[model samples]
Target: MQRFAITHAALFTVDPQDRVIPDGTVLVEDGRIVAVGPAESIEIPADTVVIDSGGKRAVLPGLVDAHSHSSLMRGVTENMPLMEWLPYYQLEHRALTEEDAYHSARLCYLEALKGGTTCVMDMFRFMDRCADAAGELGLRVNLAPYVADQPGKDFFSTREENKRLIRTHHGSQSGRIQVWMGLEHLFYCSEDAYRDAVRCQQDYGVRIHTHACEQREEEDAVLKHFGRRSIGMLDHYGLLGEKTLLAHCVWLDDDEIKRLADTGTSIAHCPISNAKLASGVARTPDMLAAGINLGLGTDGPVCNNSLDLFEEMKFASLIQKATRLDARALPADQVLRMATIGGAKALGLDGEIGSIEIGKKADLVMLDLGAPNLTPHEVTHAGGNLLWNLVFAARGSNVTHVWVDGRCLIEEGRSTQVDEGHVVATAQTCGLSLYERCRALDHLRVDMI
Candidate 1:
C-alpha cells in the first residue's frame, strides 16, 4: 500500500493515440494509478515517495507476453519441424518435478521481468507449482495447465485435476495468479478433451488456450481428419470464443481469419519461433485487417531461446514486412500495441492493466534512454520517438526498472524477488539433471537431422 509520485519521465502513455508526453507525472497509491498526465496538471502529495527520473529515462506500460511456456531447455531445440519439435523438446522437458517446475518458473519470470514484461500467459505442465512460483515472484501470470487425453500425446493433466487447480489458484494472490483451460493443440486432444475444454470454461468461467494453425502439415492433418481447417474445426467444438487465446495462427486462410474475428478469438503470434522452425509467416496483416486482436509471444524459451519482448517486437514487424513485400506492412506503433494494449485485450485483461491511465493498475517499465544502442538518430520534433528506439534498437538490458501493481519488482536492472545468481544456478542444475533423465527416451536421444 505504498504511495508514490513518479515525475519528470519521458512518458509513452500508449493510450489509443500513443501519446508521448515530454515531462509527465504518475501518481500511484495502493497498487493502482490515481492520476496520470503532464506534471502541470496533477497535484502531488508531500508524503508520497517521489520517484524522479532525473536522467534520460522513458516510462511506458509493462510489456505483456501473450503466450509462453516455463521450460529450461533454451538453445536445445533448433531447426526442428513444428510437430517434431513439440515432442522432442517439450515432452522431454515435462519430466520436471515440483521443485524443477518451481525453479524453471522462477527463471522464466526473472528473465521476463528483467526484460520489462509484467504479465505472462503461460501454458506449462505441473502448473500448480508454476502458479506458486509466479505468485512468489509477484508477476501477473495466467496459468493454463496443458490438458490432452490422446494416448501417445497425453502429456497433460486431467479435467478434474485442472478443476482442483482452478479452485486452488484461480483468484489467488489478488488475482495476479490465474488458471485457465489449456489444450496443447487440437491435434493432441481427443474429441472428449475438446468437449471438456468447453465444460471447464462453462463450469468455472475460465478462459481456453490452445495452439492453432501453426504449420502447413498441421493444417493438412487436421483437414484430412476433420474435413475443416484449424479455426473451423475448433469452432465446431465450441472452443473459439472471446476468451479463447490461440497461439501461432501461421497457416490460416481468408475464411479462417474471418472465423477467428467472428468468434471473437484472439491470436498470439510467435514470430521468432515460427521463423526459426521454418514455419510459414502468419497472416498478421489480414488478421488485423479483419478486426482480430493479435498479441506477441516468445512461445517457449527452448524454441525462441529468449523471452525478450523487445526482440519479439522487432521480429514481429520485420517478418510481416518481408512476407508481404510491403515495407509498411507492420509499423512500429502497431507492434508496440501488440506488445502492450493488444496483449491485454487478447487476454481480456485490458480493463485492468494495459495502458497508462487513471485508475488502471500501475504496471510500468522504465528504460535507460542513455543506453548506447538507443543513441543517435531516430529523433522526431519532440525529443525522440521512443517507440522506434524501443522496437528497433533497445535491448532487454536497457530496462532500468519494472513495476507490477505498483510494486517495484526490478530496480536498476536487478531482480528484487530472487537472487539472480541462485536462480540461474538452480535452473542450470535442474536443466542438466532433467536432460540427463530424459536422454534415455528416444525423442531426447534422437539427433535432429
Candidate 2:
C-alpha cells in the first residue's frame, strides 16, 4: 500500500477537456492515481509521503516517444539518405555483440529518462537486452525486435527471435514492458514473412510495427516490388488496422491517408529524423485533417541525435507550419497532445498512462519553473505562458523530476536507479570499440588521430 501525494503544482492534464489545474494535487496509491484536483479540494492522508512543489513546479504526463531505437550510433552517421544509410547502419548491427547491445540500451534509456520520456516504443536489433535494460531502469516500454526475412535483410532479427522475445518479455516487468511484432520494413519482408507477422499479432495479441513511406522514392519502389503502393500493399496484406503502428508515412497520397484513417492505423511522425535524412516533409496537416491517430517520435539516437521530446515537439510544429505555409498548422497545444496522450493512443496504451487524471497510472514529469528559460511561466494564473514556453522554449534541462508507476526514478535531475557516470563511461568505451572492430573509424567525418 505505497502512497504519496504531490501538491501545489501546476498540472497539465491532457485529458478529454484539456484541463490545466493551476494549483493542483494528485494522490497516488499502489502505482495508480487515486485522486487529482485543485490543491484545496483534495485531502492528503497522514500516512502518505507528501511532495510539496511550492507552486513553482509544472507537472504533466510523461512524454511518450512513440518511436525509438536502442543504438550506439549517435553522432556516428550523417548526411546519408535512408536507402544509402542502410548499409552503414547494417554494418554496425553485424558488428554489435550481445554485451554491446546491453550497453547501447543503457545509454539510450538513460538519455530518455533525463529528457522526461517515460514510455517508449523501440524497434531495433538485439531487443531482449533492451527489454532487460528497460525493466531495470523502470520506464514503460514496447520492444519490437527488428524482424525481416528477405535474403539481403538477414542482418535483422529473425521471426523466430521475435517470437522468443514476445514469449519471454511480453507483459513482463510487472506489465511495464510489452513486446510487439516488429517487421523491419515492407520491402525487407517476403509475403510469407508478412503473413507470419499477422499470425504473431493474432496469436499473441500483440501489434505490428514497421517503417512505411519514409522516403520520397519509397512509393515507386514498393509499387514496383508488390504491384501496389506502400499503403495499398499493406492493406492488401491485411496489415493496416488499429493494432498496427507505422513510422514515417512521409509520402502517402490523400487516398492512402483515408485508408489509414478508415482502418484506424496509427502513425509515428519523426520530423527531425526525416529532415536529417532529407526525406520529404510528411503531409502532417493533411493527416490530422483526415483524423489519423498520429504521435511524435525521436527515431534512433543516430538519426535524431537526441531523444528529447521537447525538441521534437517544437520541430513537429514548425516543420508542418513551414511546409504547409500555414502559421496556424500544428499549434502548440496540439503538438503537446501529440507527444503525450496521442502517442499513448498510437501505442494502444492511452487508458493506462498519458494524462494526470484519476485512475490513470501515475507517470508524470515535473519541470522547475524557476529555471532561467522558464522564469516567466507564472502558471498560478490564467493567461500564463507555461504551456507555450514548454513546447517552444523549454529544454530537457528544465526537467527536475520524473515518475513512472508512482515511483520516482529521476529526482532533482539525477537518476536514482543507475550510476550515470558508470553508464556514460562504459558506453563511450563500448562505442569506440565497436567502431574500431567494424573498421568504421575511417568512415568518420574526421581522422581519429
Candidate 3:
C-alpha cells in the first residue's frame, strides 16, 4: 500500500523521548513509518495521500551528512591548509571525467537534495557516477569510493575498486543506496592497505570510511610515517572496530579519545571543514564525553563551500559554543541530535533512517514554518523557541518539503526529481571545464593567504 499522510505538522520527532509534536501527523506506509503522533492522536486513514502541513510546517529528521565530498571545486579553492590543500586537490582530482563524475554527482546531489539533506556520507571520485547521482536525485547515499593505497596516493579508489563499489552499489536504489569501505588517509593507506581495508569491512557487510586526526599536519604525518598517531595508526591496522567511520578526528589524544569511545568508532564531525581548512577544532565536546559517536559533516562541496545541513546545524552549534567558551557547549538538543539521530548513528543508518519513529524509513524534512526565520514556531511542549529556532534559525531556505523513501523528492520548493535549472546549468559547464583543467595542470594556485 502506498499510503502517505503528513497532516498539519510541526513534528521534530528526533525521538527516543526528544519528541516535539505540535499538530503533527506522519503515517506513510509502503515506505515505512506507520504513524507518528499529535493531530489529536494519529489515525488518518481512508486511502492516505494527505500532506496537509497547515500548522505552517516544521517536521524534521532528514539531515544526516556524516561527511561528504562530491566536489566541483567550489569558489575555486580559496586560501589553503591541510597540507596546502593537497596539491590543489590532487590537480582537480586529476581532471575528472565519467562526465565529470556525473556532473559532480549532479552538483553535490543537487546541493544535498535542496539542503534538507536526507542522508549523505559521500567520499568521492567517480562513485559509479556517485551511484548514478544518487539514483537520479532522491538522496540517501553513502557511496565512499575515494579509497587510496599510498605510493603518492595512487590516485585513489582501489581495494579492487572498493570491491567494485560493493558489488555494484550495495543495496542499490530501492534501499536508497550505500557502499562505504573507503580510505584516504592515515597517510593514505598501506599496512597492506590497512589490512585490505579491514578485509573490506569483513568482506562487505560494509562500513569503513576514513580520514582521521584531520590536521596538526595530519597527526604529524601519521606520526612520522606510522610510529602510530592517526588514531594509533588506525589502531595499528586492525582499523579500530564497530565498522569504522572517521573523518576529521581533528587531532585527538586522551588516548585518541579513548580509542574512539573504545572501538564503537564513529565520528564525522566536520565543523565547516575544520574551520575552513585551518583544520583544528574537533573534540566535539570531548568526543561527546568519551562515549563518542558524534555526527554532522559538511566536508565537501569542495571543502564545504556549501551543501548546507542547515549550515551544518548552525556551524555544529556555533563551533561548540565558540570552541567551548561554554555557554552550554553543544546544546540545542545536542546539536539536533548531531544532525538527526547522530547522523543515522554515523552512517550505519540507525535501524533504517534516523527518527520519526514507527517503523522508520520515511526520512522527512519539511521546515517553512511560515518562514520569516521560522516565525514564532512554538512546541517544545510550550516553552517554545522551537528547538532554538531549529538549531538557531534554520536555512537551506526553510526547506519546504522533501521526503525520502516515501517519495516527495522535494515539493513546495522545487525538484520532483531533476532539472533544477538543468542541474545548475550542468554544474556551470562542468565547473568551467574543471577550471581549465586546473589552469593547464599547474594546479591553479592563486596564492592568497
User: TM-scores of all models?
Assistant: 0.96, 0.96, 0.36
Best by lDDT: 2
Which structure among the candidates has the greatest TM-score? 2
Question: For residues 282-365, what per-residue lDDT tens digits would candidate 2 score against the true structure?
Answer: 998889999999989999797989999999999999998888789999987889999999999999999999888889999999
| lDDT tens readout by residue for model 1, 145-262 | 7776666554456667778889898989998987898887766688888888899899889999999888888889888888888788788898988989999999988888898899
* 114-219: candidate 3 lDDT, tens digit per residue: 7788888888887887788788887788888887776656666778887887897898888788887887775566778778878878877888888877778667
At residue 375, what lDDT does model 3 achieve? 84
Q: How far does residue 15 in candidate 2 sit from its true spot (Å)? A: 0.4
Q: Where is the poorest 10-residue window by lDDT in model 1? A: 440-449
Error of 3 at 328 (Å): 6.6
lDDT of 2 at 30: 96
Off by over 4 Å in 2: 380-383, 440-449
Each model's lDDT comes to 0.85, 0.88, 0.81
What's the TM for model 2?
A: 0.96
Better of 1 and 2 by TM-score: 2
